[model samples]
Target: MKRIRASVIQPLLPDDDVAERHGWTSVEDPFDTELDHEKVFFNEYLTLAMRVDRWVVPGPLLKAHLREAEEKLLEKKSLERLGRKAKADLKVMVLKKLRRQLVPVTKSYDLVWNVNDGVAFFFSHSNKTHELVQELFERTFKLRLLVESPGTAADRRGLVAEEQRAFAALEATSLATMEVAS
Candidate 1:
């Protein structure tokens, strides 16, 4: 039986804007193997690196929630002085609980299966699996899959020209008002 392997190279954090700036690209290379070796390797190397580098919590939603929690706690303290120390302690406790619930933000996986053809399949571990896979695909391909075609080059050029004209007009107006009483 022919063997197929699926490997994914994803950023520890979903955003990873620095990676994009550094021209880091994710690519999946599938190869054919004769051995029927079902292997699963879970190395803590990547996770450790991510934790050290602070590349966790790549999504804005999670960050926003954290910020909201902090804001609420601050507001509550500012509004009332009754049992202020206790309130502060409770807030700390709540924050700690939320941190624990915050999922490990950086993770990637590789699945090597002994199968025929290049079709890669896997069981759904969670409802977020599909979304996560799609996110990985976008990062790996560096291509956004949109329903319709985006703006053309000419359109972009036109927009740039309009912006330049607006800027030039503003500059001229500002310069014209300079008083030169000599």
Candidate 2:
């Protein structure tokens, strides 16, 4: 499911900082995408992008393991060994079986970096996935990431003195109305 989307940004660190960035290398086979790391450059800025792929075993699949554990626990001699430790060990066995039998669901995220602007965007709306990207980028490049929201983008747009003053004077208002009973 493609949900998380973000705008591009300038690089917070210098080009020199990117050198020896543990895993920073040219992207390969972007596959029908505009982000081609091997050849494309926009106005002297580096176009950096990559795909992060993961395998997630479905919850239902794992839940089935719990059911198996319960069934195993209820079996004749197994019922006598149904202590906490035994149940936990049984669950582990079921998990091992499930792991062997099922194929993990695959998911991929595409991230693009606007090197000149210190901005990067990832195609994910999930908070957990966003954190994963944030940590991965920081760990790989040794640089901090500032996730740009719409409000932050507007702030970065450089408003004029008078416009900034006007914006500051604005107050919050409720957009919801409650119906009153007659």
Candidate 3:
């Protein structure tokens, strides 16, 4: 079974570094796919974008096609049913044929890295999206990032022990379920 992989990547600032390997074009003008030093290399901040293309085949569509292909195979071989290996081969062949007629679904996300400051930001609300960027960043730069949240950020900036205790003891408040006196 396929799983969704994602992350939020932070750069390990080492004076100067850039992601140049397997340079994929941004989700902008296809013809103008430029990743130049001037455009990419901002001494303090690196603004980047990623475009991921994925082939999503519908389960029902695949089942229908596979069933039709199986029937044809059985009819051709004059067999009651296909063997396990034959079914697997047919599935692979069917997927390849279907893939040719299908366009990949593309998703784009932007990331801003502040090398001077020990922080980076990926402009996506989705946890999955954040993970994807992180995975990409790790692969490209060979660096893992620590997840930053309200508590983590506070701890990093050394918010006193008393406040840290308060942060740890804090309960999640749902605004929708709360009484708002306007």
Candidate 4:
């Protein structure tokens, strides 16, 4: 059992097609590989997890390669004789080679969804992971994720009858004051 550090609840809009869909549907991974996408099911709590795989090269290793390439070019002639474009091209080539040697870095997060309330509880607090999850969720369900907090949940949740009328009747007023200390 993981403790949820932060949570976001989004109300599913009425008429969304997902309401009609049943059972778990796996979402395609946009990053890479042919591994089957994780499944998302309609249940008391729908648990979703996404694994992000990225090939990352070490900065120091990349820099060393670039420096070595530059030095070899210099040994061939004069460093001052090398054109800016030629130097840039060499650097780009070295970096590309270094990048090719990189191994994948995989990150995964488990998300629990409450279909009844249209709320999603992400197990992690990392904003990067959350953004990825939101994107994946929307793409998988063809629905939007509206972040819900205590202060904004009421307004975000669809207004009902009297609440809708009250919302429509409300007028906006600036809370800021023009008066300033001399």
Candidate 5:
């Protein structure tokens, strides 16, 4: 049996220290200057693994399995991007045709999967668009889905990992050095 695990990441409210670390201003401030829109970005990660008891599938079969998974994931991503663009265009169309200030809703989502763990995960920031995300997965992958809040421990661990990754990247850059050795 293959196992899949996924989580939708919510934006953490930036504390003073966190803001300084990330060079961010107030957490409530909009990411972009336009429209004073406070944006929330969502990220998803998944790990997949096959049961050890099960015999390893042949190379051809494994390739087929991976290809199918990739195709489905790509299709879903394309649809989501298209939907967002269409909605934006529709908003413009509505404003021009009706002369009303109606704003069309838009959402962003992310998904990442690890075949080694046999897990797939998805994340969406918009609660209203989550149903659509779930429905798309079910239709494309034939997998039933459920949403649950992450435990405090898991959330903490994730945050720590993110901080470590960011620090590692910074350390790799010459900009972090104090003086030239020359």
Candidate 6:
């Protein structure tokens, strides 16, 4: 219980942002994986890194192992066939066991927040990574974030009513070269 209190109290937080982000992002020397406020703030920039671990098990490999396990169990029990529910249960058990022995793939992303400008940059383009960053950032700061866009940036900078309408009126321009049939 004491360890839990210090070492990132929550592991998974897909729904609850505040409760999940208590210690997951706000930390000094984030490279050490210690999520807490020690030396987090440095000048106008708030920089941190997030590490994600995922276990990827091959479907064919899992299926083969499950088949072997089911056959062994049936043979040991002297049974002709196992029930569907029993097979499903066995598959789950086998998967859990295999998952323990497998190594997890780790991914890390860095975030730089310029508080003065109220702008934060996440150094990745992956949609999946973007979602994770969004969740982590909102939870840590308890402030809503808008995805980066020209309009949003203008709005964030407190654009005047006239500039806002001008920005809204802009249309896409084509850069294609035209052929001159002389």
Would you list the clashing residue pairs of candidate 6? 27-36
- The local lDDT score (0 to 100) that residue 77 gets in candidate 1 is 72
User: Model 5: which ten-residue window has the lowest total lDDT?
Assistant: 16-25
Q: What is the TM-score of each candidate against the true structure?
A: 0.24, 0.54, 0.68, 0.56, 0.25, 0.69
lDDT of 6 by residue, 4-120 (tens): 124332343222222123233333343354443443457887767666655566899899999999999999999999999999889777776776677545456667789898888
**What tens digits encode model 1's per-residue C-alpha lDDT throughout 1-182?**
11112222232333333322111111121121122322222232111000111233335755566566666866877853336575565545544454454533333233222223222343334445444544543454444422212344334455677766654465323444436743
Poorly placed runs, candidate 2 (over 4 Å): 1-81, 158-170, 173-182
Ranking by TM-score: 6, 3, 4, 2, 5, 1
Query: C-alpha displacement of 140 in model 2, angstroms?
Result: 0.9
lDDT of candidate model 2 versus the reference: 0.52
Residue-level lDDT tens digits of model 4 in 16-80? 22221111112333232222223344457776556554445577887888888888888888655
Using lDDT as the measure, the top candidate is 6
Clashes of 3: 8
Instruction: Name the better of 2 and 5 by TM-score.
Output: 2
Model 6, runs deviating above 4 Å: 1-31, 76-87, 175-182
lDDT against true structure, model 5: 0.37
| Model 1 C-alpha RMSD to native | 17.1
Q: Write the per-residue lDDT of candidate 3 for residues 6-120, one digit (tens) a residue.
A: 2222221212122111223332332224555454447887656765555666889989999999999899999998889999989878876776677655556666678787587
The TM-score of predicted model 2 comes to 0.54
lDDT of each: 0.36, 0.52, 0.62, 0.56, 0.37, 0.65
Give the runs in model 4 whose Cα sits over 4 Å from its true position: 1-42, 76-88, 156-182
- Provide the lowest-lDDT 10-residue window in model 3: 1-10
lDDT of 5 at 152: 39
